[model samples]
Target: MKRFLLLACLSGLLSLGCAAQPAATNVPEAIRVEVTGKKNGRPLLLVPGYVAPGEVWREIAAELGRRYQCHVVTLAGTGGMAPLTVAPGASYYATYARALAAYVQQHHLQKPVLVAHQTGGMMALRAATDFPELFGGLILLEALPAPFAVHNPRLTPDSLKLPAREQLLSRLVSMAQGTFLQQQQMFISTWATDTLQQRRLLGWAAQADRTTWANIVYESMTTDLRPALPRLQVPVLLLGIWVAGKAVKPDLTHAQVQPLFERQLAGAGAGGEVRLHDTAREFIMLDDPRWTLTNIEQYLAAHPSKR
Candidate 1:
């Protein structure tokens, strides 16, 4: 499934290049932008999840770009064709948030709206709390307002202990065998229903630095964004997935996740909305980009700019 998708995206890219056309207009190095629409608008910034790049929002961004200038941020040390390092605790989140705020100020973006996914949603919460004046609202996708209970066997404390540097290096070398393909499969099975989109996402993951993958995994396990949620002053939207049946992992129940969001929204004293999509899981955006985009559009419309 993934292989077929990869081939299709590659073919599409080649076709576009051959036809002297572009699929999407990507900013060269500017990770921030001014909001330009039919009417002046607030900037929309997208923050991606662990092991994923800003391109994960490509489809949605292109659609939204018609109405709102969109800026997709790929965290400096995450999945990119660059050297990587382990980001210390909340420092990465804080630093990126500050950088984004500074960019907004520099470009004079009107109270940018942050659209974040997975761990990126946590970072957005931290940013909104720390710099309320720099943001307008937040759209959180598949994020828990509190720390996820460490119950998944694959994400246990013992399982997350950082591998020794040398051991990690060895593992990197071994990853050359079939690790890349395995990573590709893991991403597809986890986030995508369509084989083409799965392959496109896998290609991005394959290009990521080994250290980035390890560090992201380590940070994801240790960092908890619950404390920052109560401090936010901006409006928020929490989009949670509702599994059809009892999850194989009993600890990851929808009931357990709901209270965390409700508590945070109540604490924020900000307009908040929660929607449970029963058919979707952790990667709701990837599974149904149109639905995600529609929800966001309606939210923004309902909360039109005061200016």
Candidate 2:
């Protein structure tokens, strides 16, 4: 799938001489934005999932770079970006969302299409909700409306609060202060499925600030975006991957999964579209890049934004 997607993207590209090549760009340090691709092409912002670096979009960016200006963002507390220190009582994700909007405005990107994954998708959704005029479209890769909403339908912030807060916080604090190996072990065991990917994610997580990481997770868990969905005006494409074999309900069928995602996203605005991909979990990009990229291309084509 990886090779196919790479070739497919490369084959579709017009000759480089046909269009002006992209130039490197320098962005402010408040939010980590790695700019690439044709300066004249339509802008596309890539946001990675939690604990993931902008590197997660490396292959996708390489392909999309041929046709669009790609802005790969690494939010504070994730990957190599340093934790964002905010005033007391401020939410980290909320602060990051505002900073991201500022980055878009500062760059003068006119209605850039936003492609985000997992937690990053949530952040982008919140930003778009708060600043509806800033974005042209949204593509959410395997994004959940609420974390663990699939496992428990009745889940809410009040019901989902983390138990043993002090103990968990202490553990995260120790992991932050501990050797790289300790932190890496915690990261890998919890998230990564591939060995090399595990190591790469670990390297970044080790550099992340513990308080920032813990706070974001807590915030993400408590955040419920269902209410804000109907308020959005931009087009949204949700690509969901359903692997029944890996599911807790191994016998789960698409019939069941589709409606669950729909229910979770029922409050989404009229512009929202939900698609289900039959593939494995954890590494959506690596496992089926072709399907992922093809859907993304279709979504972009449907949206048809111009810089």
Q: Please, what are the lDDT tens digits per residue for candidate 2 over residues 56-151? A: 899889889999999999876667666676655466556666777777877788998889887778888877776777788888876766755655
Tell me the tens digit of each residue's lDDT in model 1 across 145-215. 44333234134344444444344434543556355566456435545557776776667666655554544
Each candidate: what lDDT?
0.59, 0.67
Candidate 1: pairs in clash: none
TM-score of 1: 0.72
Candidate 2 clashing pairs, residues 3+ apart or interchain: none
Regions of candidate 2 where Cα sits further than 4 Å from its true position: 1-29, 151-154, 164-167, 176-194, 244-247
Q: Where's the lowest-lDDT run of ten residues in candidate 1? A: 17-26
- TM-score: which candidate is best? 2
- How many steric overlaps are in each model, in order? 0, 0
How many angstroms is residue 226 displaced in model 1 relative to the true structure, after the best TM-score fit? 2.2
